[model samples]
Target: MTRPTALSVALSLSLPLAAHAAPDAAVVPDTTRDIDRVQVTATRTERAVSDVAATVDVIDREQMDRHLVQDLKDLVRYEPGLSVTSSATRFGLNGIRIRGLQGNRVRIQTDGIAMPTSFDIGAFSNANRNFTDLDTLKRVEIVRGPASSLYGSDALGGVVAFVTKDPADYLKDGKDSYVGLKFGYDGQWKGLLGGATGAFGGEHWSGLVNVNHRQGQETVNKGDVRVDNDRRTAPNPQDRDGRSVLAKLVYAPSDTQRFRLTAERNEDTTDTDVLSAISTAVPTPRAPLTSGMKAHDTQDRTRLSLAHEIDALDQPFADSLYWQVYTQNSQTRQQTDEKRTDGSRRHRVFSFDQRAYGLQAQLNKAFTTGSVDHALTYGFEGTRTEIRQKRDGYQVSSTGVVSTTVTPDAFPVRDFPITTTTELGLYAQDEMRLAGGKLSLVPGVRVDRYELKPDVDSIFAQDNPGLAVAQLKKTSVSPKLGMVWRFADQWSLFAGYAHGFRSPPYNDVNIGLTNVAFGYTAIANPDLKPETSDGYELGLRFIAPAAYVSLSGYYNDYKDFIESNVNTGRNAQGLIVFQSQNIADARIYGAEMKAGVEFGELSPALKGWALRSAVAWSRGDNRTDDEPLDSVDPLRGTLGLSYDADAWGVELAGTFVQRKKRLPPPAVQTNPNAPAASVYQPAGYGVLDLMAHWNFAPGATFNVGVFNLADKRYIEWSAITPGLITDRTLSDRFSSPGRTLSASLAVSW
Candidate 1:
């Protein structure tokens, strides 16, 4: 039998099979019929999904509960164009990946406040961006392309905005008091989750409090090898725990004026047995280097904010106003313990911390002049952030003699000096309606000024004898234009052009390191440039009472991409040198389609039946080196069928992914004695999932899901690394989980 390809399945599903369908009961709702849904992240103001020129996706509280969502991976399970990066050895998720970019390029925020940036050092320490709890969120919005025109720096790739629930959400329908409780279990991680919420409201005030906790073990995989060595494919043993708290208060003096205050905290801890690092090889057969390893990691975040809103004002400058002031603090600490085969021990500790304070405000006005209608919006944002990082280690012999100076590095060293960054931005946008509201035009622009100042202290000076830290100050302007034309009753065409950029980070600009014993060193660079991109998108949409379809294409060009720790030959002292540089130019293009229909439109007997499908394809190239970019994912698609009734619903979904075919050629070995370079290319695979929900009682619901029904052993392309090709024995370590089950129950009063 011939296997089906990604292109074939995508093209076949893009056709309309029936007319008008309900939302998927188990997964995300069909986008075709969600035209009336309101989203605010795309334009910084409330707008219907159909009116936005850019591609956007929304996940609400109802969807999250039905899907039994747990983490970032489960959040994007049905999204083809987005993914989460992870490490097999580290045993944790890194962050969200949008398009072909990940890490610091994509911006993540909660309640209009930015999250902490991710940072990594070698293989022992990694500070990730998984700081928010899913249970505390009411809605999540994702913008696909460049959004820097409105959000400023760090939005060069895209934006993810998380909106937390308010006291009013639970005190609706004239309820004076409310309470909710929830419990859940996940088979893959053997985890148990519990949460509780309470809310109270009166004539003039409202308040709410929520708390959630989870405890779990290592995630299960298909690998069965139990040997303790580098060739072992099974996941290392681990124990993890997490907790979060959210509280809010609101005061309303009148129908047009309101004030809100919020507080939140999240903490997570993990302990892992690093069996993958256990090896018996060393300088010679007589002396082995490592025998065993263990690690403990912790992360925490806290936030406080106050906001005010006023609407229906008669002022000349604005009809509505919203403003907020917030402060956030986050930290990460990691410790690694290693035992040498020759009766020696080593320990290392790494820490990273950040503090931020910011304020944001926006005003909106609507008026008419002559034959044109205008809706204008303007906003300003200012922020200040301070960052600090440190690493400490010690080595001891069998006789209990400890030393701070190890073989490769010294103890308590700073990778970069204490740095502070300040930024201020001003932006405005106008939406003009012309030709009797058939044509809409939007023009927006923003100007931002940023400054980075470094404080070199005694610790940094002692580590690097004679190094100079660089200070950066620059101003940037971003502009965007968008148009929507409705030529017919049910057809619309939209197009957009945007400019985006990301400022240079502290670690990349002034990194300092020395390894005299290993004959190598990495120095700082002061001439790094900010990365920039220009993006364009065009799309067409057809919306009818029975069916909905959308097709879009996009292209993006990037310049001055920064590549860190690049080898730049030897220094004057004959030591190998490395530095960060801006050297790459690239381009990425893609196409996507979404279509859905309801079987009920065809016949009354088929009522409550629906089908939804979507497909995405993309390609990227590194123009500077004339090679294919490996960060780009392969083609992918999803299809779902569901049946809904008054009290119960069920759905069966399938996810298909194509094999990775585009890769750069292997590097040539300049020295005959060096190892050869290679790449890992994953094979195409498809998986099926089944989900069901039942509303057995009033204000109570239960959801259950069975994923990977066939128990197929497969590896996600995003988890595969190029270094894995050199050691085939460790290939199974990257394999995804087998069949798993998840169930949850919630009750409200």
Candidate 2:
């Protein structure tokens, strides 16, 4: 990645207003001093985090400014239940696991729009863009646990929503302007610059626009032997450049009615070279060299929203109506070369492109049951996603001979074809208050109709005739129940039980016979059952006048969990490669707690300061097989203390992660020659961080920080070493950037 040269800056400045206002908002002035309360979209409706029915974590602008958090991974340390794993390249698109569940189970959104690009096989890798870049953000909200009833598919684990900054949120009296810049060195060169502006009539309308760019060089590890040849501190060779533009517009005719439109685009390019150690039967050990892996990815999104609140309805059954529509387009391409000492060489080129469109409308009604308040929420949501890929396979022998196995696949491969999935969901949730607000019962149900269509599936016709001749469709209904009892202002208890389901991905539901008519071995199964799970949870929330405490515990039981399996227990060329099948029951139980105190409560000397800490302990096991779940961390926690004065603020924080015990893959028809085993176990480690913020002037500020104070070595997960005979090595490991330093400056008027 290259730095933003003067030529690039001039080009950006020369763009016309039409190009800059592609989305919907306008740049307003004086936007930094308004709206102390932050609203989140965790639910269809807007509400404060503390009032939400579920556990929610809010990452505010102040924190983003203080930490210079440029991406999702940077924010993970502050979130109690969120964890991210990824390579050094920001283009690698980190994976987020919430409460031990990973992959497509979690729902990610921008504002109220759904981002459903996790359809490609490599989509889990470096095929998608991360939801970061602070120039266009207002705040972020994370909701933990099954949210299927509200979000539909892909919400089996949890939901993360990136709420873009609205012109109104940043503007003061609906008028504000601001510019922010960040510069840092993390054993490597890193820099960032961005700005935003807000302008609008106090109560009628508002608009905003923002742009930012970031660049950084690769980093190395200290005394790390995993990648033998790459002796540099940051051997994984990486360079990145990203630029984004966002615009928003809103109209509010009255306090009860509002309309909004938003648009954003992000373009980024990345280059990375990967090297790993390998030893074979040869005299001298040879390490595989992965050279010239380059990728370019882009994301564009647009949304339109409308909301209205009414107190004049003839009946008490209706209180508000809201409607929203959003669309997203993302494209990613990766070109790679692999070389090994065994004389085996391969050239791989692949591109993943996806488009998703969704629409949702909801009605919220309030009424009285006995002397208690009852609210009913009902909504309809529809989503359509299309995934397309183009990839070529190549192989070359040690004799300097090269052959092409296959060229780039067309729009739709004949065997697997292009898959399109569409879903329609109808759901309703009821929240009833009893015993003078001391007890509340919330129950929800969602019915979803899903249809997966493949353009062509000739290879699957031999086993199931329905696949090649036409298309297939599947659907399921999910339900949820929960209750909360508020004993006092400082003490509250809650419990919940929810049922969720997941349909097999189109590429993994093969069910066929011997190689035959379709020239392929396996077929597609139209009758596959949806994977299901039931979960029970209990929690407590205690908030005193000057302190806060939160605790939660949950037990989850799963049935028909999808696991990878080989159809015929034999590997033959041109065979239907893999299928998703039901596996034995699994259970996960864990506890999480976070507490904080206001220094002012202890004594006057400790005024203007605060202290906070959090810890989470989780364990998952396949009860039927008596084995731990892969990638499940046994223990994790964070401790932090901060102080603030009229002119400055400072904070110190530390994080700890315990080792992970490896486990086998989901399932198989029968055990193979070698049973699956653990390759590496990551040892526990800790690091400290420091941050300081100073208000230099009425509208000027500066922030400085140090990350990875100890430069400790650690690993997040394990990966396999590439070679003729693949070995294993832990990934996402490093000797922490060796005490990096960062600083930021900002001005607003």
Candidate 3:
């Protein structure tokens, strides 16, 4: 996993382009630079990004400040067949694996609603979703693979949207703008504030607030230093603190009415520690010296939208109409532990709260077709969800009290269970123009009907007894075909195909489970079925105005893929239960290539220099037990080189990940000491990152970075173990953190 010679391809085709090189519809309101006319909403409409045909990756805000990207798995790296995983306690047990199938099969959005809260609950791999907060992001669209025909049923490994900001475009010439901050070092401390506001009479407002703190220290592997019991544990050098807020308000009293308001809030707390399995020089009898794994999260969202451009609908079919309403509230508290013997210790706690609501409406118009040329659109949407869960368990000792206490009948208790879903969709799209305008075609179709209802809970209490209702209708008809062939004058070539569906998981009908094949207890399965996927893509672009290069390929096909099994023995409270199934198909295929060069002929000592790089490769499987698909990652790539002027700029990037061969699960084949282990393959590492940015004025800006850079020592996969180590730190693992450095300062006033 190290081959890019020829002097790194002539130093990546001789860097250049850090600014200047826009114009294709202009309108780019700085959200961290590095843009190529970016625009996308995964086809709900909003084109551009080379007229979409799929394969889109826009991380604007100037490449998230040259890659000091905070959160969302460092903004999916240079994205291209995404991959990210973490569990064993590390702030909400991170997870994301496009083209490889990740929990819930990828489907996250914002500004387009649709927050399903992991279907039937269960997925506290720490507490999913990890709510976003990159200072109220203004851009981030990764429509890679699969899209469930424009978003339906988790989209099967594809779709990630997070777009925000538009408070009248955050005023600038009338005043009101700001930024403030500190940075990372030693313990990775962090802090940054925000601001934006300008209109008063015509009514327009923008607001943002941010806070991120990190306490570093523990997280070592190939050099020891990773303790969890027997001392050393207190959020260890991995404590985190966060707070984010965004507010926007807009009003356009005339010119056909317009009003909008948005609000968002985020809170975070993540403590780490989960290493146990022995070693650090032995010591394993009555374990428990200290164990940890904690998480706390909070999310809040609000949105209201309205738009009009009527002249009595101008009578001609339609002119415009739009409406939106969104609401969200999420809360989670999680914990996990291990440290027993007699000294005692065994914990697991997860508390949940979720709420989601959405409503949407759309319309647009323009006409003509004979000689080609048109514009038309349509849409409809509705959504609702509510969930609440509480679980407490313990088995303490070693002076910790609580000998044992875990009941809700020891398992089964779905209290605040209320699921009432509704969705009805009807869509149409048209945008045709031919030769004269250099060619174009956009097709669309949507016919959705999703309904859910599963009240369950009746009396909640397990030992095997009670609710298992079942009913969550489904109906789909997704169709979208696209093409944009502009033969030159900025070149173009796009392609698309879509179809998605998902239903059957409203808590999977009261989640019944109580095994005991040979002795007693039995009850599981409540007619589960419903999960489909199909997504396609094609692309080729060379948009001018600066420079752009794109290439794409994607494929996905999944059907009834859900698994869980371990009907090994006991039950009736004796333990060992687990059953959940429905599997038989899965596939993911891929290819993605990106290139950017923005040299309006740099000279002034390499003016705002420009140069960019991207690379992606994918291969997913599980074609009904064909293997290779428990956590996919076969290749990942990134390359960057930069230098700019204006105030200051610097960037040097390099990242590559490859190596995966660990797949164990399926009830470990009845343990027999579980032989055949080493699929132990992890030997693809490349790290080198450095960044710097400065502006000091005009909305202010300052950023600094340094990550990895030679202090290398790898191991990011090998049968999970981000805590609960000991096989000599599991032959010492986890590594990937050193040579740290960070800095940031911002002001937009």
Candidate 4:
């Protein structure tokens, strides 16, 4: 709990609500403008979140129905340096982490399409990037650092854009037609949710449809051993199902042209009994070499899109324009069933697939060059992707013989090959506005080209029998600069510098694996390189009307970075050689602060009270092994208190964590009796949550939440496992989740 005891427990829970909501005499009426929120992923356009200069976060749909949100770790659960990476053993949300980077280096998109690319191979493969479906989101944008100068190549640890729900967002007010319904329940995964939305319009047509479903189990843990080898942590029996569909169509023949068409689908399935991979000790302790396990996992995503928009164009290059053409398909499948105490049987299947086709375009202009006022933005993007992977298995002995030479796997393989990836990007941004606008300047640039091709079939030439599957091409350039200075009248000062890149993927340039009964061999690294970053930010803001404050600082530096597998030793048949390297040089530094207030603007007896707070701190380093970068995450804080009425609202929040003392140093116990490599530090915690909402009439609404409210059993340094140091008694299967409840109800017509 250090870091000054987590910054004095977040300043003793937000300094008495900021000294009892200071704001002395009449001034309130921001009405939660939230710094005039309008975000488009930090500069893909639409700015204003106090004029973006980095660091953005938005989660609308009324904060996902007042926080009854059920996925993406409850949508960032009070977001502090963002996180969402889960894996209670294979397939359970493995994506989204920023600042400490995460799989596929974080870039997820929904409406603008690009999602899928998270693959893990080994204990039966895992491919995840949960593929969006938060009740057909109507907003979610998070851009935190290094957005590859307008998103190119996974943005190198940032970007999460998702925006769906249009049909005029439910044909609002002058409502042509609309319908909505929702229901939900969640008790840490006793889940059940249902949703539907429909809309229709006229004046040149509009249409929308959305559907959702969910069912669940298995997300309970606070371990009570529960038998089953490895001293189980009570969460293995599982069954979860999910479904989603979204559709939209819009057209407007005039008044500045518009056309849109979209379709989406998402599916998720999970079934597991895996009693912690049952075991009874080895061939010596209890005569059991394994017994009973089951698993079935599936994830799917499909999308189709066509979009075009042009507004008031007077073309000198463009007045405004936007375009999209997309097609996407994603899949991940896993099946494993085993039972081997001797009456052997094992079956495995793992597949990861992706297919994409895309085109995107953007253009905008607002010229003036004599007195410096320009707001240009240009774009181009192209994509072609097809990635496929396969791993199949067989073994059925004891008396029913059938085997694909299973002793160390050999049955339909193809860990990498059949890869096709092509990408092209070109970008530009301007935004100048001089003194008359109180100083503002943004500059951006992007140029990217990446290609990788590998076909090599025959099941990857019968599993690495002479390997050589390499072809890659790369080019990149990213740049960014930003500044803002609205000196007074509510003050502001912002600064930024960014550049980020990530290429060299295609399963790490042709990765292949062969295990001679675990003697290990994983080889393929076709001179890989392209993981870079350089970021810097500085900020300060204060917007008043009822109060707002923000403070920030950041630093990032990375190069090559990409370390996977890594052993690189033993060859000549002694096996044990692994690769995938561009060895790592890194750095991360951070700070953040947030504040809000609204004590009825200071009168009317605290008109609807409000207070909010936030804090984050970070540090990471691995300068090529100088240690400590265990995916950095520690020091977090949040505090909230709210009350709103005109139709009810309530909130009480509190999250404070800082107890994962930067890991990575143990490991050096050359068997002095075995067992001593310690790593599992997770001890600081504080949790409290309680949400409420109730519009209850005219278009109904009712939401509820009560998370952790004192049942605290925390642990979420992105679900542990960094520098593992051996199981550590399963760490309660990566804890978190003790007191929980969620409720939702929504209706409209």
RMSD of each: 7.2, 8.8, 24.4, 24.8
**Which 10-residue window in model 2 sums to the lowest lDDT?**
14-23
Q: What are the models' TM-scores?
A: 0.94, 0.82, 0.33, 0.35
lDDT for position 316 in model 1: 99
Better of 3 and 4 by lDDT: 4
Write out the backbone clash pairs for model 4. Answer: 28-601
Top TM-score model: 1
Which stretches of model 3 miss by more than 4 angstroms? 1-48, 53-55, 58-75, 78-93, 96-141, 144-149, 155-405, 408-431, 438-441, 448-464, 476-504, 508-597, 600-688, 691-749
Q: Candidate 1, after superposition: displacement of residue 605 in Å? A: 2.0
Query: How many clashes does each candidate structure show, in the order listed?
Result: 3, 26, 31, 1
Count residue pairs with overlapping backbones in model 4.
Answer: 1
Candidate 1 per-residue lDDT over residues 393-492, each given as its tens digit? 8989878999986555677888889999998999898988999999999999999898899999888889888877899887889999989898899999
- Tell me the spans in candidate 2 whose CA falls farther than 4 Å from its real position: 1-53, 88-91, 119-126, 129-134, 174-193, 219-234, 275-317, 337-347, 393-415, 457-470, 510-523, 565-567, 570-577, 661-678, 718-736
Candidate 4, poorest ten consecutive residues by summed lDDT? 16-25
* Residue-level error in angstroms, candidate 2, position 556: 1.3
CA-lDDT, candidates in order = 0.82, 0.59, 0.56, 0.79
lDDT of 4 at 733: 80
Q: List the residue pairs that clash in candidate 1.
A: 20-546, 20-598, 21-598
- Which residue runs of candidate 1 sit more than 4 Å off their true CA positions? 1-35, 282-288, 667-677
Leading candidate by lDDT: 1
Please state the error at residue 23 of candidate 2 in Å: 18
